[model samples]
Target: MKTDKTIRTHIVFSIAIVASALLEPCANASSIVGTKHDLSSYTNSSGQICIACHTPHNAQADQLVPLWNHAATTTQFTLYSSVTAKSVPGQPTGYSKACLSCHDGTLALDSFGGKTPAGAGKISGANNLGTDLSDDHPVSFTYDTNLATAHPGIVSPASAAFVDTAKTVPLFNGKLECSSCHDAHDNQNTFFLRKSNAGSALCLSCHNK
Candidate 1:
């Protein structure tokens, strides 16, 4: 059993490495500027472009987040609020700005600086991610006491508290990201989720429906 598990893990890592290399050229800063092509070609519908998340310089440990080139938007994002808001408000948590930096569609897609061929200019985007995030799912809030009270059956603060700790240790501790539910490299489901069709199935992965 142990050997099988190790082999599976190795296979997954190997596959990820190959996929990332194939998509690296597309991640070049130039493409994000104005080069218009099917962005979906690099990775499956999951939006798992290698350069999009990783970087050549100053990449995260083992290059999980990778050395991304674009500057993440430091501005405070408007988080979802309601009586059911189990987490704190307007703080950077969950996948937070790191994930939204691109999905929000406001910051320059290729804003992350990268080594480009000579004579090439910096990449910039005309599509601004508007302030209205109501259309998208909520992010950047603390999953503390309130969540325990409302959705005690589902969310727990234990994972949220480890965001900083997980970075140096296991690297991932059940935190949510676009990939938390969706697989950016493989478009297998309606929303690129890693499993069966989304909607309730995706929610059920984390929550009890």
Candidate 2:
């Protein structure tokens, strides 16, 4: 007994509901906003949370990304290297340096936005990577066809199957970095990982074994 107009209205409403449901997760606030990274405890009356690592103007000029408010670390790192490792990791560059700005534990957490807060101090506990990176996973390394050939266990980044999916490990300018494994803005998975490591799926994304 319904008219064509009524049927169209119901269809439109259903589509709108489905669209909102799909976009909810993406619209949700990032975990880093109010988490320990907030650094408002040491900030001087600036209640803005994102200001800890980002700014609207006067960002770091040398940084690859825009709106970088934090001071980049200068500590020379002892990069991860092993006899079995094929890729040559030179140094932490790009987003890896942005993560190390606070995580390296050499600089004060509140040392951002061109103003160091009073009683500011370095990061502590497991979050502190320090100047030594020998114990951590190798970063800032090329992960291309040559490296994949040397280490047959790893899938080539250029492979269609490897690059087709959204969950795959990302490379920055054809080089793997900390952001390759971790999504700093998202914490849907543990350790801010790009994808859930359940059943070692995240690890298996690149490594065949």
Candidate 3:
């Protein structure tokens, strides 16, 4: 009782299923869909992942980041300081400030889309960097040939935009920042690191020792 039309429909369905299976790996390879940063669970959200940090239209103009959706943090952070260190870091700026909007404990994870959060869920435990940044690795500082020449154990940067010739590590406007080592979108490496930290390989990329 097999009709020609029924057989053709079956063949088309089978092809669609096979095509979907082939494209799934590509989707899972690089996306923020299931990552910790995906905050689409918010009840008021559009149920889209990128809406947490980006918008298609009317993004905040004051924010240096492209299409910024989250409210900027206004905390006057206590920066890292050292007597021997040559790099004099001032206040946190640009991308580092963007990351601190949630990590600083001042803003909720759902503090985006220009609406107040329903719950006070904040970045806690080790994920919270807090207002005091004395202990953490120094960010939002200029790292160039001048700094490298003056500072010990620091390697000279290939260019203002990137740290390595491979260009794996990036700098925000010639300054090293939180995003320099971390890639916000891809979590293929844990902690959202740009590369594996095994044996401090990521650290060695910038630091000579």
Candidate 4:
């Protein structure tokens, strides 16, 4: 039989230990946890980390995507308007909003998660890519799948691309997602593109004609 004081002390200690363990993962998850974002290197600010873009959290409306912060862009983006473009924008669909959350330059990159550094750390810094998105090709809508419907499928059986044997990355009916052409990690192609469509091969991969 222990005194009430002894029991209370033990309980308090147990709670403290459990709390610390739970916080361990949260602390470790951040690449720029306590340390401020390096101004010289352009690393993300405090509380923002690699997990900010690639984790399990509130995420975006797309649901297919991983963790994301920053408000999804609502303004109609300016795209590369030309005859060569095979897609047309009707309202951004699928995870296209999530892709724009970063690429569109409307939202600050470190707005979500926890605290971020003030002043120079803001994404609006001259070097930080901002809302003028005209340079990148348009990405809100789906591509012309009818053109590639005739090709023999080349994707692997277990690959995500194989679910619809006839479907292709460039031909998805839904909105084009960042994942459509890029795999966030360990990409063999430059800019994390899913395949080597460099130069003309990239365009010809789907637009066979």
Each prediction's Cα lDDT score? 0.48, 0.80, 0.80, 0.49
* TM-score of each prediction: 0.50, 0.79, 0.81, 0.50
lDDT of 3 by residue, 107-163 (tens): 888778786675478878889899999998999999888998898788778644233
Greater-TM-score candidate between 2 and 3:
3
Residue lDDT tens for model 1, 77-168: 66556675454445444344555555555454554444223322323354334455544555444344356567766534355533333332
Candidate 4's residue-wise lDDT over 1-209, tens digit each?
A: 99999999999999999998666545534233322231213334453345555446666444434555434556575555555444465444445665555555565555444434343324444433345445655666544344224233423323444444323343344445556665544233444455667575544444334
Candidate 4 root-mean-square deviation in Å: 14.9
Better of 1 and 4 by lDDT: 4
Query: Which TM-score value belongs to model 3?
Result: 0.81
Q: For model 1, what is the C-alpha lDDT against the true structure?
A: 0.48
lDDT of 2 at 123: 81
List candidate 2 segments past 4 Å from native. Answer: 1-30, 44-46, 116-119, 166-168
| Model 2 TM-score, all chains together | 0.79
Top-TM-score structure, candidate number: 3
**RMSD after CA superposition, every candidate:** 14.6, 11.8, 9.5, 14.9
Global Cα lDDT for candidate 4? 0.49
